[model samples]
Target: MNYERQPYRRCGRSGLKLPAISLGLWFHFGQERTLHDQRAIIAKALELGITHLDLADRYGPPLGAAEEAFGTIYRKDLRGLRDEIVVSTKGGNPMWDGPYGAGNSRKHLLATLDRSLKRLGLDHVDIYYLHRDDQETPLEEQVATLDHIVRQGKALYVGVSNFTPERTAEAASLLRELGTPLTVHQPQYSLLRRRIEDGLLAVLEEHGVGCVVYSPLAQGLLTDRYLDGIPAGSRAAGGRFLTASDVKPEVVAFVRTLHDLAAERGQSVAQLALAWALRDPRVTSLLVGASSPEQLEGNVAAVDRLGFTDDELAFIDRTAKEAGVLA
Candidate 1:
């Protein structure tokens, strides 16, 4: 936790400044881990100057466990330091089986935020986001409801995730008209996943909505732990999210080339990938998850040496194209 953090950037045109590397509690901060273990990671993150903590209502295996976990961390380690941290949580994802349990409807969005606030033991979160797009619900209703939440003092800022560029633009406009602009867009952007490159990046840039990309390592594919094959105690081998079949021979070979490139730069593949995503000034922060504090520290190390030479960029393009990651 002795790493030095570079300068932080503003989220869009907002006055809020976020750390270059933010910690996300989406995957690991759950009921499965002990409260002491969870608090330890938060403590480690704060000690390392990671000031942002991202959570959601449905982040737990049993639902709402992650926020409650945060409540425990807040009381134990973050009580007096709340003002120094930026807490973000999302709703609009199904947490219960009933009809009122999901979607971007005002009813669901408003009620869910109240519940999320209660769970986190906070009056209002720094930033609130829609977990996903609800095609069945009208876009205007969602945007208006989010703006209303800002007015009601439930959320300071609003954002959207997993939204298409067209829908993102529309939502931004709606929020803009109300004078409560959309602060950021949380998209799943990584070397392995280039879907965001298909106009989403431009849309956010044009609208002045900053991006906080998740899964920059593609759920561990870009890491050295998967180059030889799916090793024990890895995400792919867990048979839960990323699977062995997803790690084809071509993918492994591609990872090897990327790993070589990272070595040439005196960095890990994880570090290289994280640095690559942050190269865009439009990216406000890279939201990363870690099962252990060691992993968290290792991931943030990429922020130190992010200057890639022209030749390195060319090498990256060639290697990524061959792996079908740049196409």
Candidate 2:
């Protein structure tokens, strides 16, 4: 395995050291891509030093397919190498039809994790996340469920995704009281999505919880693909997760300028966006999704040049403001 491609960072105060770029099974780990393709991408990632595999119970198009398929890959390709991997999956995101199917109740969280384990063909996962915050459920119960999962030996550590700074801090305190400790936080972070800059990063830093950031490419917007215009057969063209309406003229202009900055730095536009996200020392790792091995290789290369000049950061900030995406 080419494990020296990227550096590893400790996940907060934990002993776990995650690769600078981790692979996410959030996309194409299901029927949208063939099992051969999924296995190949995963193999390539592992070969390139990406040991963290991020997933969710509701990730696949038919739900649970992602985990089920990864189980097959694990047994076939990685059973003996499990010790080298940091496998993670999420629950509490509506995997079934019952009222408990979606909430963070103890029943839902525990049941979902059991199913996730069964599908991944593992007795335990390194990290398990509450995929979302359920306001309808009591926060105490939700936090307690995470603590229970860790105590039950289902997860080595616990985390939450898409949670606000206040909720994250509260959960951290509760988990600390329970002796499990919130290990990491997965947030949507990129040059285009600056919501976490408000307080979440600070909260994680304060609580000593590592940040595993996802969508560092901003759903393909921070790439050179949109620098000229939205090409056909692109994410924006599909009008699915990324709408064409989301791409304004100013956004395109900003991307073009960002592309030039990336060229000057000997990286792709996506690399610049990713490196920019990693500039904050508080960020532990980035959860990057790839459709192919080539894409994964390119994203991994971003680690080669993660530092930025003061002037470059200032330019990015000014462009983001001019593009009206600072939010």
Candidate 3:
């Protein structure tokens, strides 16, 4: 892998640097996809210098399938490159049947992490996250649990996902007192969803924490996947994650306008969306999923034209907001 192919940014104020574009095993890394195909996507990502891979215990449709798949692929194809790669995983999502199944209590978090380590066939992961805010668990307990994990050498850094600005600030404060600063915050950000711009971005900036955005393409809404109407096996067509109501008449019109803009810029719709998401320097990385090597390569090409003129940014924002994409 050529490191110069993609740029790297510092995560928060920490010493760790993640790729501008990190591969996420959040989708298409389950039992439904073949191992051969999954390996090919990963191989192409590495070739483009995407050294960070994000995983979670509950990513798969069957839960734990993603980590299990990565274990086999890592042991066979990526064993020698362990030091060069930054692996991340999350817990605190439901993975079993009973009350002991999930949430951010120390007992569950540590046990969940131990199971994750075992599945990844590693002693520890570079970064571990509390998957979501657990209202049932005390804030101090959640923050201290993350610190304890780092102290035990089970996770080098800690982070939180899908959290509100107030909760994130509180967790950051608690972690700071423990001497293990919060490293990153993963939030969904796209032209179709700009909630992070409301308050979370400022919070992370004030706390010196980095942001790694996911769903920058709005789960295919901003991509060419729906240009010809939803295909037979598309996510929207399957009524999972995305639904028919999401593909409204006005939304389609907006996407078509976006396509024209992308074509004028000599980039794919998905590429333009990725570039716009990374326009903010505070966004250290973008986590994307791909089902094929070609798709992954196209995403990496987004870095080729990261610049946007003042007019372009203003137009896109005004148009998106007018079309109700900002909601």
Q: Number of backbone collisions per candidate, in order?
A: 0, 0, 0
User: Mind giving the per-residue lDDT tens digits that candidate 3 earns over 32-53?
Assistant: 9999998998999899999999
Tens digit of lDDT per residue, candidate 1, span 224-304?
Answer: 887777789887888777899988777788889888888988899999999998888888999999888898889888988
Could you arrange the candidates by TM-score from highest to lowest? 3, 2, 1
Q: Model 2: per-residue lDDT, tens digit, 53-106?
A: 999999887899899989999999999988999999999988788688888999
lDDT minimum window of 10 residues, candidate 1: 1-10
What's the residue-level lDDT of 210 in candidate 3? 89
Residue 94 of model 2 has an lDDT of 82
* RMSD, every candidate, angstroms: 1.6, 1.0, 0.9
Which candidate order results from sorting by lDDT in descending order?
A: 3, 2, 1
Clashing pairs in 2: none
Q: Scored by Cα lDDT, where does model 3 land? A: 0.92
> Which residue pairs overlap in candidate 3's backbone?
none
**Model 1: which residue pairs collide?**
none
- Shift in Å, residue 44, candidate 2: 0.8
Most TM-score-accurate candidate: 3
